[model samples]
Every structure is written in C-alpha cells, then in structure tokens.
Target: MHSNRRINVDPAKIHCYIRELDRSLLRLAKSSTSIKSLTFIDSELKRVEQCIVRAARESGNLVASRFGGILEISSKGSKTGKDLVTDVDRASQNLIANIMSETCPGHVLLGEEDPPDKKQEASDWMWIVDPIDGTTNYVNSSNIYAISIAALYKGETVAAAIWIPWPNDDGFELMHARKGHGTWIGDSKLHVHPENETGVPATGILSSFPRWMPKAFNINKQLMENQGEIRNGGSACYEQFMVAKGSMQYAITGVASTWDFAAGILLINEAGGKVMRLNSDGLFENFNGWAENYKPDPQTYERLRKWRGLILSGPPRTVDFVAANLSLKQPRLFTRIKMLFNN
Candidate 1:
C-alpha cells in the first residue's frame, strides 16, 4: 500500500459511522433512497466482507499452483470469442455463493462465472459476486486474482467490498463502502481527499505482483517508464482497496471483468475516487454494468467516462494530464460527457 495514513481503531468507529449515516440521510431527503435502505444493506455487507476474506485468499492461492498449465476453460456464448467461463471459475463462484447463502441466508447472490439463477436476480437485496475477478489470470496463474462482492438494493450499490488475497510492498487491502457513509480500509474510514490526486505523490498504478504482464514487455515497459512504479503480486480487489485508502494512487489491470470492476467501481466511488473503462472508444460509456444495475444511469456514464482501464483514482486535472501523456484515446461519448463532468 502506498498510503501513509495508519489505522488506529477507536471506540468511536461505530459512533462516527452512525452519525455519518444520519447526516447522509438528512442530506438525501427525497433525492435518493440509498439512505433509507443502507442500514440493512450495511449489516449484511459486513457479514459478507468478513466471511469472504479468508475464503477468497485461500481460493487465490489454491488457483495459483497450476501455473502455465492448460486450463479446463470454455466460452460462455457460442459466437463470442473471448467470453470464457472455466471449471475453476464455476467451482470458485459456487464456493462463494454457497458460503454466502449459509452465512447470510436472506441476501441474494449474482456472479460472473455462471448463469444467473432466478433466486438471485429476483431478490430485493442482492450480492454481486465475482468469485474470481481475473479468471484469465487464474488460468495462467498470470496474476493472483480477486473476489469482489457488492450488496445492492433497488439497483443501487448501498455497500461494496473488494478483497485481494496477496499484496505487493503494499499489503493486502479490504475496501468496503456503504452508501453515503463513505469508504473504509479494514477499520479505518476514508474521507474525500480534496488534496490528493491519482498517479502522483507516488506512481499512479500499483500492481499486486510486478511483471504479471509483459514480465518485461511493452505494456509493462511503458507503465514503468511513464506511471512511476510497477507491482503485480495478485488480486484486483486488494489493488483497488489500497487505492481507495490512498495507499496507492491508481490500480491498473490489463484485463478486467464485470465482476472484477463492478463492485470496485462502486467501492472507489464511495471513497471519492472514480473508475472508468480503460481505453474504450464508444458513443456510450461502457457502464460495464451487470444485471444488478446497482447504479443510477448517470453513475454508469460517469464510471466509463472516468475510466482508463479501471483506474481507481481521482483528480480530473491529473487524470487528463496523465491520459494525455499516455496517448490514451478519448471516447466518442467524451464530448457529451465532458460538460456534465467538467465544472
């Protein structure tokens, strides 16, 4: 983690959490329902967060052993070339779902590795679970990987968590967000950093493992040369978690999935940063949305417009400056989205 803010647990954590909840509700009034439902959502989320950490870490280590081995993988859609679903993915997602159901029977579960069951999609409150955010990484043991979970109510992410098993020089991170109560890393709650900007103060991107990609290749070369530091240990959930803590300026993954970033997008946003599509050039910003659709329409566009391959970062001026220097392409929706984003 690139952050200097150390965690010191006080009895006040609960009091502060409650006070913030009240204030957030008072401010929301009738504008949003996120306040009204967060209490129930937050409780269930805490349960999920606690139980998933060890399981997710174990799953990552379990999946990493057969490195460079042929994958027992298959494609999801008959016609789609890259939409793969694997045996490890199925087993892992099922493991998370089953554990969650046993631990939190009332909550719902939705995952990327399998077809949605009516039981999950129909529930009032649902948990979006990406058993393994980086499945390809699992196939090759290219990078360790992550498990992301976000609890949603009425299609808005009231609470979200991203867990990465292993951390680089930065240790493993756990990021949780509860509506307007703000974000947290382990026990330390985070605030909107009015001063810190992404990719500065330290290198923007933090890879859990260094050389996961390009072990010395082009993307790696450009990132190290331009971004400042490179680490690639394992796990997107932890990487994004560190960024939310301001331990890392940005968390980058060459390839990401709906589950990989869906919860992360919501998590970082709650922490006051943003996640956007990496280098997409589309008329509509890729919401990277799921069946959960746990965000407002505006939130989707904002996420994509802000993304540079799921960069968990903040400070618009700094992002633009970095994107420009990297020669990243602006989206077709960039012009329309700019007025809404720029003050």
Candidate 2:
C-alpha cells in the first residue's frame, strides 16, 4: 500500500538517488528473464520519453484531423475566454496518463487536467504533464500548441519531452532532455545564447502577466517597454523551447502552474540556461525544491492549482537582468496595513 505520509526530498540528492537506482535496476534487468539487458534505467527513461512523444504526436494528429471541424471548447473556472479547455486537451491528457500507467506502473501522474489522488503522498516517481499547453492557440488554430511531459523522481526532473505540433514550415518538433544528458531538439543539441552575445536590444522575450495579478503589472509593463520585443505565444512550454533554441532570450510568466513550466524549466536548465523566480526581492533562490518535495495532498494540490507567481528564465545574464529590473507593485496604504496586520 502507498503511504499517506507527506515527504520532501532535497533536490540536490535526487540525481544521486537516480544514479544509484539505475545501477540497481541495471543489475536486476541483467538477471531477470522478462527484462532485457539493455533495459537499464537510462534506456527505460528514454523509452518512456519516446512513449510520451508518441502520445503527444498522436494528440497533435487528432487536433489536425479536427481542424476546421469543431473544437468543443469550454472554460475551466477562468473569467477570460483565453483560458480554455477543449476535447483535444482531455483526450491528449487521458492518452498520456494511460501510457504512463501501462509503461511505468506505480508512478504518480500529476497533470494539468488530471491531478493525482489527494489521499496519496508525493510518490518517489511523479510524472508531470501538460496535455495541450497552448489551448487558446490550439482552439484558434494558431499552431503554437504543444504537449509537455516531465518525470520527477524525488523532486529532480529526470526526463522531459515537449512535443510541438507545428514547429515551423518543416513539420513537428520534439524537444527532450534527461538529467546530465544535454537537451536536444530532433538530433541537434540545444544551447542557450552566450551572455556576451545576448543583448536586450536584439533579444526577444515571451511574457505573460495575468490581468488579475496586480504585483506583476508594473514589472511586466517595464519588460514590455524595455525588451526588444515581447511576445506571448500563449503556450509556456513552447516559449521556453524558443529560449532553449536561442530564438528568444527569456520567457517570463506571472501566473504559471507546475505543468506549465515543469518540462520547460528542465529544458532550459539542461540547455546551459537558468530558471529563476522573480518577486520583490532580487535574490536567486532554488525554484526546483518544491517539486522535488511535492506532497500529493489536497492542500498541496490546491496550492499547485493556483498561480504560483512569476518566473524568469533564459541565459544567465538575461535572467539576472530581468530579476534585477522586475519588482512587485506596491500595495496601497490601507492594503499594506491590512496585509501587515494579517501577517
């Protein structure tokens, strides 16, 4: 039986644990007749990655098949019509969840559309998924949508895959990464633009600050005014992939959930870039810890369901620049007093 106890693992130790687990699994695979000798942990992870990509690819095809047909769209408690959920989204998520269940049994599935059970603890193995990232774009036939999936073992992102349905004039694109194994798009390795070469005047940024979030208003405004160009692709994963490919300097979002940024964070980090939190303080705290120690409880899931706040990511220099410039909007006098008294 799975434990109901909540646990938090240090992010730093996750890679070590995965390595040890890989070694043990390798030995077991060699001995077990049912397990092929090549089915080591790394290969197993890659297999899962491929499975996710396949599911996402098929989902894209489903969307393509329905294009110009009818997309049964609806809102998921968002006041704005831009925040949408569609039949394709649910279908894609269901497909991913089922594949994970069949391929990697016992793993926890935490998806944007289908979260794990509230009674369980954060499992040692957690698969984070965003079935259709750019729902708004997808619904409108913008071709900027993507399916994002990531494997989190004890809080560290072990493997991630972001499948872009229509990457360019060519065809679909798959960006994926495994811990300690560089990020890749198709067969080419991805690298962040060098600090010296990435200047703000020429750099493009993908930013989104929900109109309801007051804290990000001034900061986001400044970003729009100062950055060379600010683009909102409506899909967080795709924007992060653009950053990873050196096409964009940074992707900043004020209201991001785990599924929205999980795969993207790993992608940028593995591509020699940095993902940093942005708030009133300019301090660079570790943002990966929360996911590393996630608890699958109602309270934790409730918090994860809400917007967590702002994230700035890209080349180190670009991240630092944005962090330094962005500051929370100050509360009014009465609001400040109320907040202070409440605190």
Candidate 3:
C-alpha cells in the first residue's frame, strides 16, 4: 500500500538524496562539486527533453483526433461554471502518463486532470503536465489549444515541450527546450526579437492580455497605448509559443496555474525572453524560477495546484516596458478595508 505519510526532505539536501538514487539511470553526479553537478543535470535534462517531446507529440495527436468529435464535458466546479474538463483531456493525460511511466518510470506525474494519489512518489523530480491547455477553445472546436509537458528538478524547470496544432490540419509543431539549451521548433532554434532602438516593437506587434481584465483594470488600455496592438488567442500556451518564436511581442495572463505556463515559461526563457508576475506589492516582478518554497510532503501537490497568479512574458526589454506602463486600479475604501482584514 502507498503510504500517506509526508516525507520531509530538506530542500538543501535534495541534491544529496538525488545522488544516492539509481545513478546509472539518472546519471546524476555523485560528486559534491558544482561543476560536475551542473554537467550531470544538463545531461539528464537532455534525456528528459527527448521523453517529454515524445509524450507531447503523442498527446497532441490524441487531442487532434478528437478535436471535432462529441465530447463529454463537465464543469470543474468553479464559481462561474465556465471552467471545463472533457473526456479527451483525461485521455490525453492518461496517454502522457503511460508514456512517462515507460520512458522515465518512478518519477512523479502531476497533471491538470486527476493528479496521482501517491504523494510519496514525488522524489527528486516531478513532471507537470497540461494535456489540453485551452480546454474551452478545444471544446468550441478552436485550433488554438496546446499540450504542455515539463519536468521540474528540485522545483526548477529543467526541460519542457509544448505541442500546438498546425494550420490547415498539417499535423502539429513541437516546441521544446532544455535548460542551457536554446528553445527549438523542429530543427531551428528560436530567438526572441531584438529590442528595437525605441525599446519596443518596430511596428504593431502581436500580443495578448486577458479579455476580462479590462473591466477591472486599466492594463488593457496601457498595453494598447504603449504596445500598439493586442490579441488573445484563447490559449496561453499558444500565445507563449508565438512570443518564443518572435511572432508576438508579449502576453499578459490573468490568474493562471502552474500547468498553464510551466512549459511556456521555460520555452520563453530559453528563447531569450523573460516572464514576470504581479506581486503582492502590486508590481510586476521577474519570475526567477519555480518551487522556491516547495515542501516535499503530501500537501505539496495541493500547494502547487492552488498556485495562481497573473503573468507577463516576452523579450526582456519589452516586458520591462510593459511592466513600467501597467498599473492596478486603487481599491475603494470598503474593498481596501476588507482586504486589510482578510490579510
């Protein structure tokens, strides 16, 4: 039987624990030297990248095959009842999980749909997956949905793969990256557009912001005035893919979970871009990495699942420019008092 007891491994000792694991399969350096550790990590990440790319491709095909078919959909029990899950989403995740079990067995698998019950399985590495990222778009027969898969080592994303549908039913495009390796689409490496002389896009650039944020904040207007144009492709992963390829300048998402951006964050970072998130100070701060406060316990999955925040990602200069121009609306007196009391 799988134990429910928490395994409290100190974050600082995680590397030591990893070194003691099956070294032949993991290829982790047994040495304490930082150089050797980094080298081993890179080598392992390369293997992880290959595994996830295959998983993403298979899941993508599964999603595409059911794109227009009748799907059994249900609400995720959100307040608005708009958040949805479908049969295809569960099937896609199952397929990805099966592939991971074969290629990288014993690693923890976390998916947007039904996470694993064995929290003790989360050892040194965990796979974060979003089998169908744009579920609403997929439900509506839109081609903007994507499959995202990423591997996190000691809470830091080390490898990622995102599969997006190609236009005209031309199969899918797989964008993948490993830490210290450049992001790639097929054989070509991706580089974000260079900062223009004005520290912005030369002409209007394709960009995205949450459609509903305009009602509560002026971020939409600020983006339009400073960034020139705006568009929301209904899929955060798709928008992030565009940014990684230099086709879009930036994208700002309202309240997103880890699975929504895990793969894209690494993709953008590897493509010479940056990601920022709205902090408690009401400022957009650079997102350095994930799992900074991770606890290796049964509750860790819940902590990650509950993780939600606003995100802005793009080329560093453009991201800074947009962050500078954006501001939140001041709360009303009652709202401020309520917030203070709640805090």
The C-alpha TM-scores of every prediction are 0.54, 0.74, 0.82
Off by over 4 Å in 3: 1-36, 78-81, 115-121, 168-170, 219-224, 332-343
Listed per model in order, the count of residue pairs whose N, CA or C atoms clash below 3 Å is 17, 1, 0
**Top candidate by TM-score:** 3
Query: Against the hidden true structure, what lDDT does model 1 obtain?
Result: 0.55
lDDT of each: 0.55, 0.69, 0.80
| Per-residue lDDT of model 2, residues 205-309, tens digit only | 344334443443345554446565666777778888788877777667545677888788888898999887643343444465355335655545444444354
Greater-lDDT candidate between 1 and 3: 3
lDDT of 2: 0.69
Please report, as a residue range, the 10-residue window in candidate 2 with the lowest summed lDDT: 334-343
Among all candidates shown, the one with the greatest lDDT: 3
- Per-residue lDDT tens digits for candidate 1, residues 1-343, read 5968888877798899999999988878855666657666667656655665545555455544444566688767676546666777777777777766777686666577545323222355666677666565666655556667776555556667665645454345556666666787657777433433433424444323234333312333334455645665456665666666655655444344445565766666777665554333321232323434434344443342233233434433334434443322344434433333321
Deviating ranges (above 4 Å) for candidate 1:
1-71, 75-85, 116-122, 167-174, 180-185, 188-239, 245-247, 251-257, 276-312, 315-317, 320-343
> By descending lDDT, how would the candidates be arranged?
3, 2, 1
